[model samples]
Target: MADAPPPDATGAGKRRGGTSGKVADFRYKRPAQPEKKRRDARSGHERSGPERSGRERSGQASPLPSQMRPDAGAQSRAGSARRQAYAALDLGTNNCRLLIARPSGENFTVIDAFSRVVRLGEGLAASGRLSDVAMDRALAALHVCAEKLRRRNVHLARSVATEACRRAANGERFIERVREETGIALDIISAQEEARLAVLGCHILLEDGRDGTRGPAVIFDIGGGSTELVLIEPGGPVPRILDWMSVPWGVVSLTDSVDGPDGTAAGRAARYAAMRAIVDKSFAPFARRIAPYRDTDEGIRLLGTSGTVTTLASLHLELPQYDRRAVDGLVVPSASMRDISTRLSTMSEAERGTLPCIGDDRANLVVAGCAILESILDIWPARDLAVADRGIREGILRSLIAADAEGERSREELQRARDVTRSGASL
Candidate 1:
């Protein structure tokens, strides 16, 4: 929707504005699957139909992410059909993101990507409804997404709405409006489904524990209106999902719950304490259930895939601004995160706004994220917070790509509770 910035001056899109957003060189932070065979999947009400690769749901082939070859015309079309493009669009409570990509061997190359903070769940915690301004902002972003999908002719695409939509009273009305206005139907996914997709998208970012002594890793997605905590057992082409719980708390909703855009140092600490207390109450039951796994004898691995963790990770690195390459898959010490959170808790709103990563857009809300993050650290008590800048979108890409390699996968891919290998790299 806007012009791309000039090439990176330092050769890293670390600058505030640039196309570094276009093609992310994801380390463990980045980079899907097959056809008609569907399951009573945990990822939502999965619709199993004909083979589609980010193509529109017409049951006709678009030929972007994959190049199908007829037994007869294999040689003639071999070099001609290089690759087809696939896309994943995620319209969450706080942000809207779209990834347009083409399959490259085991991974897909990002050709275009878009992200905007729409805050669709802005006041949902109090009002239990999507506000007018928030809906308008979301609509504008979805328009951009629609234009990108039209321009790219994405082969197979899955666009989803998360906690905000699930909670709001007028959510379906807004979904209808989206279809009417942008030609995009938003599916309000269940919490369990969201947890599953999040895992499919980000578990690879977990620190390796394959030596056996490392405890099962905990992966969490701190969304706008909710947080999905998943326990990932050590195994697979991907990490195994042992158990998961979706707590009803996220940055936007939590911030709305405890209002304090003003106050003294003491007052700010009080606000931060309030936010932390809410998260602690929400996390208590889940924490108790996983008490046996809380031992430190074997060492614990905690991983996070969300804006909260990424923002904190960026701040931990003290970057000039947001840098995906530097932040994604980074292992930040738990102590550094706590120290940053403590300093932020004491900062004035204006003071926090002046920071690079926590700008005006995120200034007020980052504190809420900090509360959630600190609470999570308390529960898992891991030494390092494994951060992933990628999540649900990456998960969708993996699922679409893996459809082709379905039955032929190894025991690791099939068993151990569902981990996948993307772009052929053995995770």
Candidate 2:
């Protein structure tokens, strides 16, 4: 592996020298926890495990489930002692997400997960800056995530900020403040890395060539400030990554740009249409890039990872509340996605808020997000759409673990090579 960039160069390891007055001035009361005991027990076990090893144990302490030990290699890997829980926090354009898991053989079971729509990119389209109201909402959510991270006793944690923070002028300042106040360093990753990690996170969901052969699949992540699309060919060494483009539009950005509160059905339709047109135009280049793969008769499946698609799945199930397991791998028909999009677009903000899936916090912007998803499907026709609740955060965790493993192997290889050279020289 190549040397990692300098700490300051990559925005991953830079530490702000001192806490800011803004951070020191505010005294935050600890939030109440209803399930404190469960959290405490989990953290206690995590703390008792090996400190440096990246291996994660099954959440079950007694014996690993047969289902959890899927393969021989996984079983062998799990035989090792467990280590600290690894945490990945993604502060995206629309949401703040965190995943805590210990490595368990080939796969990791989520010990705890947190997601909340703060719409940090709200008003960023027009203003080119994160709004104060949005920042407050995001900060509150981050505080919750930080507390959870602490309770999990995460030994190695990585927090990242995406498109909204990447584009905003004050993004660095906001990150600095977050570190000083919350002690969470936010890494604003480039679009390429973002695309790579999303594909990695969703790689397991790619269709295996069992029933019938499927061609390359396209994965789309409709984020708050930007959208990422990746094309993957099944049974291939790696995703060819035919094309990846982070469009300057997402749920929050698009909704702020086009939606209105006119309280009229026609107005809402017009808003949806307008938003659709804008997204379609933005996706034109991406469409053209994937056009060559479309004509081959090799069916391309669409896998969507973001709040937009998962929320639509939640609503389709008529779920009273969001369930990640239910929505994660759920396959929604294109027709069904269209139906939900239409229904959501027609409802007033107030009406949408009252719905089970579209809560008060996300009611207004979800339609815009849906429109983006619908527009992409329209352009890139797919047999079925897979919903993934995981994305950047999962990708980050996987990459960090993989990178650490690679680094260790590289060090061993280097030492062996040196020893061989020395023996040859002595002989």
The estimated TM-scores of all candidates read 0.76, 0.77
- C-alpha RMSD in Å of predicted model 1 compared with the true structure: 15.1
Candidate 1: list runs displaced more than 4 Å. Answer: 1-82, 207-213, 404-427
Q: What does candidate 2 score on TM?
A: 0.77
Question: How many clashing residue pairs, candidate 1?
Answer: 26
lDDT of 1 by residue, 1-427 (tens): 1122222112212311122122211111000112221121212222221211221222121111221211313333233223545667788889888777776666667777778788899888888899999998787777666666766655456677888887889988998788766667566666666666777777766546533447777889998888888776666666666656777788888999987745787789889999999999988877877778877567788889887788888888888878787877798889999999898889987898998787877788888888999999998888788888777877766665565334224533555334434434564
Least accurate 10 contiguous residues by lDDT in model 1:
24-33
Backbone clash numbers for all candidates listed: 26, 2
lDDT assessment of candidate 2: 0.68
Candidate 2's residue-wise lDDT over 296-332, tens digit each? 5667788999878988999889888877667877887
Instruction: Please list the residue runs of candidate 2 whose C-alpha ends up more than 4 Å from where it truly belongs after superposition.
Output: 1-82, 209-213, 411-427
